[model samples]
Target: MMHNATYMGSVSSVSSSSIIIELAESMGSGIVIIEGKNYRIGQVGSFIKIPIGYNQLYGVTSESNESSTHDVEIIESRSRRWIRVELIGEMIGGEFDRGISEYPSIGDDAHIVVDRDLKQIFGQPTAGQFTIGKLSSSDGIDVSLDLDRLVTRHSAILGSTGSGKSTSTASIIRSIVTNNDDVRLPSARILLIDIHGEYESALGDIAKVFSVLPDSKNPLYIPYWCISPENLIDFLCGNISEAYKTLYLDKAIEEKKKAIKTNNIKDFPTESVTTSTPLPYRIKNIWHELYYDDTVTWKEKEHINAAYAKDGEGDAENLIPPKFLPPATSSNPPFKGGNNLVKRQLEQMKSRLLDSQYSFLLKPGPWTPDKDGKIEKDLDQLLADWLGHDQPITILDLSGMPSSRLSLLLGSILDILFESSIWGKNLKTGMRNRPLLVVLEEAHRYLSKKEDGLAKQMVQRIAKEGRKFGIGAMVVSQRPSEIDETILSQCGTIIALRINNATDRGIVKSAMSEGLAGIIDSLPVLRTGEAIIVGESAKLPTRCRISLLPPNKYPNSRDPAVTASWTQDRTPENYEALVSAWRNQEITKEEK
Candidate 1:
């Protein structure tokens, strides 16, 4: 028996399965010890305790009472006035009967127990890990991850503006990297896709930062040729036209190179080469020529051919050469040019391909023709750097990728990881036992139910089947309502911070157990860093104060207050000088 158990309080009031308990003089924040045993009285989250009969009753804490115990201020909201504690589990004889019931009625002498079997419920997290905090007033509990889970499970930190979601995420990452013994987490694989370029200083030192712009120390190169052909078409053509799509598919069939059974020329002749295997080719030019170019035409029930415009330096034959059909064919003649339409189209494509914005899309690497298809050297290198390397953390800095192409870029990463882990054949021998944890940040934008987008497909698959193949996905999103319900529901553990939106709150409530649903209703009023954690990972839902992380763990999203910043008489002149030089001076391109 613990010392706090001696101060047990009895039920003083009862109504509708709710019990009101008179607080002991020594009761305080979080847990109160009574009669030599520890018991929870109030939590960071709000709830109310209800009293029923038979020494057991249902009670829940609504919120923490802010008024000093000596000077009580009258507050209208019941959640603010009374500490809510839900009846979860009770010790019955030698066995533990989980979940509280048999409401203790008025005048029932029930021992006040707050820290009821906490050790058994939350047991310490795996070695090399520590419990930072537990969800307040919810049936499910979430533990702030250190290096052990973060590196192994891959995590995404997401939230809306001012949600403290970024702070929480950065804090967790910082904890892992800083606290490891012997720097055990040095190779922890971490890839941060900075959407707004906010996490530069937060992780710059320990982890190498890569971006498209030259501002960062380590720059990323998205070679144009490295992007998958399908991804290239999607990026170049937005919501492709029906005619263009049909023609593109038709072209895909015609250009396919068949497999060669024998390298010997005597066994397979050039003229007799069959078209069965898909071949490596550029879809950007092919799609552009077929849809926008007039010189490249398909005859009615006749073979198609490309032609050069008359204004092309009079080298029309050189510009458009006969392909596929041999020169010896009797019916095949050079296609006649209708106008300069094809030349204009080709020029447009060439211009776009050369543009600065599409530079990353056009020049990826050399594409080699393989029996399977065209293999990009850049993608192979990237994969080798990410997975083949034994290092635990791989930080893929995607800040430089064009905003329009971000979805496809992220989708490709997910596809690669999933295909490599699940489809690869080495399970029986247990040789290739590498389990990957893919963390998708800002998941709501790409995995929204409204779009049913590609990210949603890949994430959904990972959520459903990735776990079996040693793959786990952590989706961090502020707007839970906007995310696909299937993916959200599939998450075994949920770490929710302060969410004020009614719809978002409701979505969280729907996925949790009935006991936890009641707890999520109070999420809007939670303080910064205070969250309601619920899931399989916790014992009984507990209200725990998350320990403060080191300064390096601070997220970049926190903005300096405008009022305070303006109050200073003199400010730094870096931004002002840059703008002035660009506008007034004939600045050299490099200087600007």
Candidate 2:
């Protein structure tokens, strides 16, 4: 017989997975001692063992009522005195396997799981086992997930602010890439999108950081020509009609044909090239030509020549508009036949080109092209800069970037990598051979359900088809409710932290499999760093406390110490420096 300490009650009733246990009246104590340790009775998310014949059925208590339960967020019910257990797996022939061949009889004995059973269930970490944390119910038990499935199938980390979402993310990633005597994965490729610039302090040691306003060895640059012309139109010419958009795209294709021939790209189908092809062309040159066409005047009824006021050729290099002769209202001669259809849009494009804040995208260093469509460097060099490093991780710090166009920029980055993956699938250097993990932090900023931005489209594409190309995405956000349902549903693993909002809780709950969502009720009250990990990567639905990252390795995401800042004595203000940093649109080296 098992230890008397393990006795909880007998199964009073049984359903397919949910079993109602009638608490043992003889054992009235709410806390029972087993092997010198006290285990709470019917604690939600704690494991329970039901013994029937030779199989030991293991289940997690989803709903349990106790008179003496007390916690930070209490959900105890006095009217309901029942313990509902959801069977998870079974132990047969000393091996743990999910599902059972036989069901537990109504009068079968239910035991509060002890250390021995937990150790059997969790097991020791082996190769491919990534330890996330200790089980919340049994701290001594380490909860590990299958690392292969996690990186291949995709995952999400979600929670409210200050709930330790970023910390847990940094910890899990660090655990994967951390070098030690036991393991050394120097080739592991993790690309983290640091939307708020919060991960550098946590992951800098193991990662190579790139930023638009760089304070490191790497300065981020995204070539404008690499952007899909449709996305470019959205950013440069907002609220444009479809007819103008088509014309704009056709112009880009024309420019691309010239670029492909001049750049001598090998085997490229210049004949079939569309606006989506990544071709290097001078954006200013295109803008100037388009504007000229819109505002040009004709000399005669034949529309031949010399309608320009005098030497009025605009400088495409300088974005100078030519002086044009006014169109005659009663046309015969000096008739300016220029349509002026896209004059406003061309001006807007020129303005964006002139803005210094967008220079990183417009006049990207090395990748920028001249009027002749020649560049100092090409996409190969740009990709090498991002991926060909000794470190296992690459952090794209997007803190100082324009949030208004974040979707287009992010989409361009993914498009570059995805297209490379597609074209290079047969090569040894492709993502299929080495694999890539893209971690999108603060994903809701661009992946909102309401917006149909390019970022969302590429993410959806990756979510649906990226696995075959060895590209995986991890969408981290505080608000799961606002994320697109299609993207959220495609995630195979969900690492949900404490979410206080009921609607957010519902989103997390719905993400879990129907059988496992029962324990998600405890989500709202989870302590910081505690999470319920479920799905393809998890061995079982486990309520685990995530391991704390090294103090120095925690993400720079802690709440401001308002009380301390208020209590401190006044210091000299530096509004001048503050204004300078704001105006320059950069986080300077000193501040970094």
Candidate 3:
């Protein structure tokens, strides 16, 4: 059926499932015709299959020659070029006949087969979608990801410090926002939690940049005071107090009773309230009131006139007079509890609440609590502001905040989105249709392999099950080994750039399917901007030069060569004068 089946090479090298076919002579044609089909068998991403024994061996045409010599790295042995693959499995029975034998000698016959079908493997997404990578070889080096994958599935652009990871992330995001035709995701919701505030200028055009204190012009407003009390405590204090805990549970029960009463449900218990309820706003309000509002305390009105003063020294602690107590209790009771444990707990809670930084959180304005410790504002509005807003990109710049709470803050936001999306089912009625993608930069700082952070938990859930619910996570980190294996293993696609660390390389190896191990071994040597893509989303794992992102739109990641600049003989003499001139211009304008 097909001709030109030349004896190009032989199986000079063999592994478990494949052999390296060394060409008798080198052939340098850019395009190779194999099995009656023309394929662009160029460098990096191209592959060819040759008959080995009973099974066929697959190899990417890494080196092609016009003469008789060439080198091909084996991918897999198959009957057809199309690799309908699962994962690693055992090879069954096979034997070599006289016609197919000879064990691939130096001059044995070998021919390139048709290019592996990528479109068939991954299938075309929507019309506007662009392919990212593919799962082709064992190395898990070549794969494709769609715009849908980049935006919705959540992606992490991870690599070492000098690996051009940021540029790769920017390039992919830009392609999604700018390149698509039919299905422009103009309203696509993306939140980049900027830890170092590095991406404001880079992603300004496509994203809403949020910055801190001095950069007040950025409209990112996360009112810490507005976060519900229970979440606030979990985020800031790490744990809640016993008395405040009791108060919080009481508030929740009371709120529940009110809701039931309004709906005309008669039976409601007055006692046995516990602090483990899911009603966030009610608990938040109780914490707020107990910690703040010195005016509400009976001790505030203690008679400090001459009667409370002893030896001209006033005791603020024991100065609570009869007039300051509640009317019925003060008139009837002498002493009940041996020691005021509840009172002591309340005092401690009050002190923590009254501190300047914490005070703001206790009674944050616009999200104030009612007299009965109920939040006045609705939670739906908060949800909409978070995910359903008009802007596609929302940057939660945490530059001003202390690093200690960064992980918790990020985690709370993630938890809210994930829980709401999964439990909030009806799109036609409530908040369900739009899915959120959270890109965690510097993930190692929060999510690690050994320790569990809230971000890691939610991220793992999204990675494993978010697709069904329209939620996904992308973990971007410099240290991949520091991240949890469960999350990394669940990733449907991986875009591994140049990695130098042996430990990091080992971790990547562990995550990939076994057949692709050799491809990954070449990782440390990969050039900048070159990557190996592998996963279910790709047709074949092929090494290819990723298209470079535009300089203006890219992150400011490249370090300057200071030594080269210093070595230059010529230097600008008017550098100080230039600065003075700019200062003079500013002074003149202010004088005018």
Task: Score candidate 3 by lDDT.
Answer: 0.52
State every prediction's TM-score relative to the real structure: 0.67, 0.93, 0.65
Model 3 C-alpha lDDT per residue in residues 1-592, reported as the tens digit of each score? 3435433444554444434454433343445555555544324334544554554434444322222222221322221121211122111143211112223343334554443333323344455455443333222233345555554444556577777777666665555555532325777767777776666556767776655433245434343433344555555344556555555555655665554334343354434323322232433444444433221223223423212123423222232311222222553422222223344444455454444333223444444444443444444555655565655677776655456655655665676666667667567313236656677778888788765656666677778877777676777888989988878776666778888888888877787766566667677877776677665433346565665655576675667899997899985564665576454321111221
In terms of lDDT, the best-performing candidate is 2
Candidate 2, residues 471-528, lDDT tens digits: the string is 9999999999999999999999999989989898889888875655667878888999
Worst 10 residues of 3 by lDDT: 79-88
RMSD of each: 8.5, 3.8, 10.2
Candidate 1 vs 2: which has more lDDT: 2
Q: Which of 1 and 3 is ahead in lDDT?
A: 3
Candidate 2's C-alpha runs over 4 A off are 1-3, 65-81, 179-183, 214-216, 329-332, 515-518, 589-592
Candidate 3 regions off by >4 Å?
1-46, 50-128, 131-144, 147-155, 180-183, 211-247, 252-365, 368-377, 428-432, 556-592
